[model samples]
Every structure is written in C-alpha cells, then in structure tokens.
Target: MPNITDEQLARPFELKHGEQLLMSSPKLETIGSTINHWVHHRGQLTVYMRLNDIAVPSIYGPSADDRNFS
Candidate 1:
C-alpha cells in the first residue's frame, strides 16, 4: 500500500462531527479490512481509523498514534 501524503489526508471530506474514517490505500480489500477493524473496535473510542494506510490529522484531542497536522 502506498503512503497517503499529508495533503491527501488533510483534504476534507463530507464527514460529520463524530464521523469515523477507515484509512486505506484506495483499495477494496484494504478498505474492507479497515471497516471490519473499526466495527470490532467501535466500542473502544470515537475517533477515525487510519487502517492499512496513512495517518490523518487530529482535529479534536491529541492523538499519540499520529503526528498532529492541523
């Protein structure tokens, strides 16, 4: 999977306030995997998931998982 650039991740989507995004390499399998993981761990937290791909900037609280971009 290719690394998603900061610009790509920073691009805004049509997401609501508490929406969760599963990060993937724009591939079906990868996207599916991310979704599956998110479903399984939905009860854990309310942040978006950057699965099998790149990291997105945190808009709310700090994310130790990825560097803050915004």
Candidate 2:
C-alpha cells in the first residue's frame, strides 16, 4: 500500500453495513483521514522519543536527528 499514486486515489471505494451500503469516498479523502490519525500519534511518539533521548527519524523531510526522509 505504500507509494499509492494519484490515479489510484481518484477511484471510489465503499464501506458496508451488512447488506446495506454505509459510505464511500475517493481514496484521497480516506488518505486525509488516515494521515490526520497518524499525525496525532506521530506527535506523541516524537515527544516520547525526545524525553527518552532517542533520535527522531525524518518523516516529511530532514529532522534535527536525521536527514533521510521516508
């Protein structure tokens, strides 16, 4: 699932409630929700890492402790 592309994100997907459809969205929108959830956890973990004196890895770009971005 890593490195999903824009062409794939434009496609729609659905969730279901048993036999009934629950909801649906483009993959990009779902990604926004997932990223929001991840950011919350990332903030907490970075704080924990700082307190424990562990080097933080680069996420979007270079970090104080690392330069490799993932």
Candidate 3:
C-alpha cells in the first residue's frame, strides 16, 4: 500500500457484516466503516469515563477537560 492514494480509496469493494452484505466504494467500506465503528466504541468509553468520574476529551471541539485551542 506504499503507493496508496485517493485513487485507491475510490476503488470499489465488498463488505460482509453479520447477516448483511454490501457493495461500496473502498473509501466507504474501509475508512468510513472504521471511523463509524471507532466513534461507536468511543461513545461507550465516554460512558465508562463518566461512571469513573473521569473527564472525557472532546473529539471534534473543545471539552471541559480541554478548552485551549492554541
């Protein structure tokens, strides 16, 4: 994958999840699925953090644990 590029991400691909299957672009099947799955688990982690009184960091913006952008 050393030569990987946006062109490769645009290629077609297939996916199988449980009883479901899908045909999609490589970018959607790979990057999109990975990010979506990560965010799903991240939400679960936040719940655990709250239960332990641990501050959860913002993923898309400033959080109470972090406010400075600089």
Candidate 4:
C-alpha cells in the first residue's frame, strides 16, 4: 500500500493496469472496490475449503467447521 492521506482520498487518480487499461476513480472508491473484490474471492475460497473438507474460519457467521463464530 502507498502512503495516502485522508485528503487525497477525495481526489481522483488514474491507474495504469494490465492490457494497457487505465482505471480512474477517487482513492476511496478504488479502495472500496479492491476490498469488495477480495471479499468475493474469499467467499469462493470458503466454498473450496468446504468441498475439500478443510476447516474454514468464521467470517460472517458460523460454518459447519465451527459453530462458535456467530
């Protein structure tokens, strides 16, 4: 992560991403988007763990692996 001040979060910036695409958004918007993307992936990971009979830590609520996380 880079050093970002709260004042800068209100300002827009461009990110040169893969495939030569440029993403433009306010810092706060980008941060929220990044977090949402990770959360989506994490949900998939939990499903994968369940399929493999691996214990999954509680994220939002209790799972079959443990009922103490609600």
Top lDDT hit: 2
**lDDT of candidate 2?**
0.87
Model 2, position 52, has a per-residue lDDT of: 100
Q: Enumerate clash totals for all models, in the order shown.
A: 0, 0, 0, 0
Candidate with top TM-score is 4
After superposition on all CA atoms, what RMSD does each candidate show versus the true structure?
16.1, 5.4, 4.9, 3.9
lDDT score, candidate 4 = 0.85
Name the TM-score of candidate 4.
0.67
Cα displacement (angstroms), candidate 1, residue 60, comes to 23
lDDT over C-alpha atoms for residue 5 of model 4: 87
As for candidate 2, its clashing pairs are: none
Ranking according to lDDT, highest score first: 2, 4, 3, 1
Question: What TM-score against the true fold does each predicted structure earn?
Answer: 0.25, 0.51, 0.52, 0.67
Question: Where is model 2 more than 4 Å wrong at Cα?
Answer: 1-29, 67-70
TM-score-superior candidate, 1 or 4: 4
**What clash pairs does model 1 have?**
none
Alpha carbon lDDT of each predicted model: 0.52, 0.87, 0.78, 0.85
Candidate 1: which stretches are off by over 4 Å? 1-26, 43-70
Q: Tens-digit lDDT track for model 3 on 1-30?
A: 387777777887766687587655677467
